[model samples]
Target: MNPRGTRLLAGRSLLVLFMAATAVPFLSLFTTALAPQGSTPHGISWPSHPHWHNFVDAFNAADLLPLLYSSCLIVLGVVPICLALCAAAGYGLAVLGFPGARLVFGLLLLGLTVPIESLITPLYYQMQSLGLLNTRWALILPLIGLFMPFGVFWMRTFFQSLPKELLEAASVDGAGPWAAFRRVHLPLAAPAVSSLAILLFLWTWNQFILSIAMIDDPSKRTAAGALGAFQGHYGTNVVLLSAGALLIMLPTIAVFVVFQRHFVKALLQGAVKG
Candidate 1:
């Protein structure tokens, strides 16, 4: 065979390999979601019957709207407080020269090592004491506080890397500390904050255990928590399970599509500065 023919065959093989590697996982997950639950012992595969109805049924079988409400409520509970606190804490850590500022920053970083699973028991008791369990506030308040630690750390790193000149220039123009942050810092930090918001929002939205434990009422459940209903109702209906997984993935997909531009911008900004 000619060398050119060999080269053409090798290139075709390489292209096929790349496409399979990239497409297979997503395609497998999607096929599994649509597949009848027990079709293959444990491996992901396509359904024998394209159970499109399962997607619609999954929505109908549960009080999905309330679940969606609870999910939104969780996002609502966690995102704003975390964002505000991070903005404030990050700004201070990046700008202020307080005594023990590094120490404070170190303590905040320590909070990251404390796993959510480890704190659940103690947090449960605390929520019980406040009579907040089974309510939206129960989930919101602790998540906000617990989530703050990471938010501060993330924002601080991003903030510290920002041009110090911008803040100083604002100060020179007679803007107060708060005014400078409102007028200048936030606009520039928009990319970082938006990226941070995307991560935190996804975390809060997909949280299952906390939502399950804190809110005893099944209706007061996040979309992840609602998956329990799928297991309960469908049990062995593999197709339904597959569809439900796909359904669960959609909201997060939408969120990323929206905020993805900001996240990309943030990375570009951070990379250039570094």
Candidate 2:
């Protein structure tokens, strides 16, 4: 065989192997979700007593709506606040040259190295002092603080990637720093901003430890906390558990799908072109 022919065969085999490796896990999960707990699949395997109602039944039993709402509230509050601050900080670090910029940014990276678990106690006490514990604000404020350093670093890197001459030209044309940032820089960084928001939104939504620690109230628990509420002393309801897991993932998946309008190509295009 020709050298090129051998290489083509190798690439095809590698592609198949990669696809199978990645896809099989998700396929197994979907199958498990559709199947029963311990019943043998004697005849049909698709679950004809299909337990289609399990989805709503499991979710509703979990008192999931308010938990879902609490999560939404937390993400909604955290993402925008973090984005603006991070973008501004990043822009400063990237575009505005200042003494100790590296020091400040390096410190942020340092903050990133410290896990959120390390600070939960101090954060809880701080929230207690502010009368914010067990409230959505408790979740919101900490999420913003914890997510900030990375957000700033990301936005700063994006801002740095832009041409300096653009900002200068805008300034020469009578644009102030705020105006340049808002009208010019912000528009160009829309994709980066959107991408960052997507990531932070998901992280805040899925945060389990903080939700469990901060919200001791049943009514105020986040989605992950609500899942823990589903267990019994007898045994785990695999169906209900899986269903809850699926529901929690639904909003996140929706966010990604919806934000593809503002993300995916836009972010990639900005990164590649800029």
Candidate 3:
């Protein structure tokens, strides 16, 4: 084969291998989820009886409705506030160029380096002292703080890469700073903002450690976090566990499927800008 054709064949082989590796685990999980409720799943064996009702049973058994509601509540609380704050902060750093902006960016960069695990103990005590422990606010407040570094960084990069001619034209048109940001830039930033919101939602939804650590009430914990306790109580039921896992994953998968275009666009924009 010619060099180009050889390279194309190699790429195709790699893609197929990657897809198989990714798909196999989910396929195994799906098969296991379909197995009779009480049976143990042994590595990809086809179930003699596919128990489709296992999903319903798992949902009810896990009391997943409350957990799902809690996850939604947390995501709703976190995403908008984080986006608003980050957008303003990023615009300030990138476009406005306020004094000490570089210092603030440096601090945020430092925060990104700090692992979440290291803060859990201090956060637990801090929340308790504030009497926010066990409340959804506990999760919501910290998550916003925790997510700020990346959110601000992501938005700042985008804003920095924005064509200055647009801002200049807006200013020439008698637009003030807030007017330019609100009327001109914000609409243009829709894709980046939407992508950030989706990421924050996914992160907040999958927040396990903080939910399990900070919140005492199982009813208030996120679906992923509650899964740990659920597993503890029903460890023997592999089918139910698999079903619950899939159930918890469905919302995120659905969200990505719906907004994937925006997500891809934002990523492509970022790559090109970077």
Candidate 4:
């Protein structure tokens, strides 16, 4: 029983405790989803006769296919464009050091302080005036804008961490800024970009407020947003509601499970670099 061994044991115990805390809600949801329809199940008791078909019923009732399509469309529209814009802006600010770069970066930082909830009313009206309301564009366009502040900040921080010698060497080889960026930095930035893409995808996919506020049609809203309507319709049917909730959560969970390594790598990279 060395001191180090005691600390390791303590840390492992804490980790297991936190893991169980994280898993309890999902376990409860799963059990409730399997409960008999229209029956309010207490706690996390397993149903004697689990209604597996509730998932199918929830899917149909929620019309999840169109919602899924809309979410995918919005993600496609938002992630790539946001990544490009943020990366370029970050490069310009960190590497190029253009005039007023600090001022511009400061403004982006200020934007991060602004709450999304505060913009909802004005955004709704703006979308209505522009005739983008009730369409996927409403969600797509606003998300790109909303994500910019954090995206640019993340990219800028990563770019600043890169060795300046790399850029200098590229220049010595007669490479232009665009060439250096495309050939040298972009490849190095894959992990950061992949991590950012995962974050934007998760945010866009789970965007409930703007999806419901801007888009009137349930099918056009994000899967998480459409859940509000599903909840409204099946609020009394706790089983169906739970099933629908789990269905909506499936894609995000799957994505995180798949790309979690990249996400963790980027985070660790930042910590080490910082």
101: Cα error in model 2, Å: 1.4
Give the per-residue lDDT digits (tens) of candidate 1, residues 76-195.
Answer: 878988898998898898776468889998998899899898888988999999999998888888888788888887777777887788878988999988998888888878888888
Per-candidate RMSD, Å = 4.8, 3.4, 1.4, 1.5
Model 2 C-alpha lDDT per residue in residues 1-274, reported as the tens digit of each score: 9999999999999999999987676555455456665433332246655666667776677778888887777777888899999989988888877899999999999989999999999999999999988887888888888998888877887888898998999999999888889888899998888888889988987888888778787557668665665654213566566666787778888998788776675556554332
Off by over 4 Å in 3: none
**lDDT value for candidate 1?**
0.80
lDDT-based ranking: 3, 4, 1, 2
| Per-candidate count of clashing residue pairs (backbone under 3 Å) | 7, 0, 0, 0
Candidate 3 residues 1-274, lDDT tens each?
A: 9999999999999999999998899899999999987888888988877889999999999999989999989898999999999999988898888899999999999999999999999999999999999999999999999999999998898888888888899999999889999998788788899999989989999999999999989899899999999999888998999999999999998998899999999888772265
Clashing pairs in 4: none
Q: Give TM per candidate.
A: 0.85, 0.86, 0.96, 0.96
Query: Residue 131: error of model 3 in Å?
Result: 0.6
Deviation in Å, model 2, residue 68 alpha carbon: 1.6
What TM value does model 4 have?
0.96
lDDT of 4: 0.91
How well is each residue in 50-167 modelled by candidate 4, as lDDT tens digits?
8899999999989999889888888899999999998999889889999999999999999999999999999989999999999999989999999999998898888888999999
